[model samples]
Target: MILAVVGGKGGVGKSTVAFGVAAELDAVCVDADLGMADLPERRGPDLHDVLAGRAAAVEAVDESGPVDLLPCGRTLAGARASDPRALRAALSAVEAEYGRVVVDCPAGLGRDSGAALAAADACLLVTTAERAAVADALRTRELARALDAGLVGVVVDFAEETGPLRGRFGAPATALPESEAVRRATRHGLPVGEVAPESVVAERLEEVAALVQRSTRSV
Candidate 1:
């Protein structure tokens, strides 16, 4: 399975949902969020090398014992509009070697997100309860739908201040509480679920992961 996790805005925990879902589904996670890649917070081969023909996608992967993270390293200027063919081929190579490919797409309806989604088998829309964020997600859904991308679902992050609002699209949207565990783990260069497995946010993310996996199977 190849899934792109994207939204039209940033800081809505898009990486959290991307990595969280990969952990739950036991899939290979790629940090396509190159501009602001998070998997590299712990250090890994830079994606810049891969894009520059200096490295293979697998060479940039970090095998952290439980799962492998394909982190994007080294910041680049024109990476946002990079050709989808290269990214697709890179990811396809990894898919042949792993169980699944979970792409951590950049925020917004830009070339980076579009290229990643264009190469994905499906997409997982990440958003929060904010009215503005919801609108952005809807526009993202439209773009994904236009490209004929199979949508997994919408993950509503930071539900501590949210309602029971479903996604603008018809897909299911589940909310998780915004907890300190998430903040602490991210700041310390660790996966939130691994750092505080029993925390409220982590538990909720696990459920969200399960939902994503189930949706994948249905496809």
Candidate 2:
């Protein structure tokens, strides 16, 4: 299955959640944010190369990381050269080889974000408690529905009040409190599970992952 981790607004810890869920699912996480790749930077043929037709999608996956990742190029030139429309095929190829893929989509309602949603079998929305963030997430949810990607779950970052979100999103909502361990793990491009397995943040991530798994199965 291909799961797209999407947040309409940036800086909501979407990439961190994507990486953590990928780690829990033992799936390859694809940094589909071509313009602003947030996951780890690795040395090899990245998503940019794959989308630019310079490399095979499977060949660009970096397995040396804590979690397998298909990193994206950081250069603006590379991003420009990449075809957003090719993302679906590339993701499909990766899923074929790896069995599962978690895509960290770029923020907003742009073509890049749309492409990721279009390619995904289902999506998990990530947002914050702020009204603006929730509004944007609502817009994202509409986009995902339009693209035919089932909304499996929602992750509310740095917030403990999940009951309202569950009703608003009509999906299971998991709260991820702000944590130094998560911050430190993200700074090093490692999943919280790897950085602090015994921490509360890690336990919450596991819950988020389980919610996604069950939701997707029903889908």
TM-score attained by model 2: 0.97
Candidate 1 structure quality by residue, lDDT tens digits, 59-120: 77778635578877645663543344578788887888885888998888887778888888
Candidate 2: list runs displaced more than 4 Å.
Answer: none
The alpha-carbon RMSD values of the candidates against the true structure, listed in the order shown, are: 2.4, 1.1
Structure candidate 1, residue pairs in collision: 46-73, 47-73
Q: Residue 198 CA error for candidate 2 (Å)? A: 1.3
Q: Top lDDT: which candidate number?
A: 2
Model 1, CA-based lDDT: 0.76
Predicted structure 2: clash tally: 0
Error of 1 at 132 (Å): 1.8
Off by over 4 Å in 1: 42-44, 77-84, 161-164
- Per-residue C-alpha lDDT of model 2 across residues 124-176, encoded as one tens digit per residue: 99999899999999999999999999998889999876767779998888888
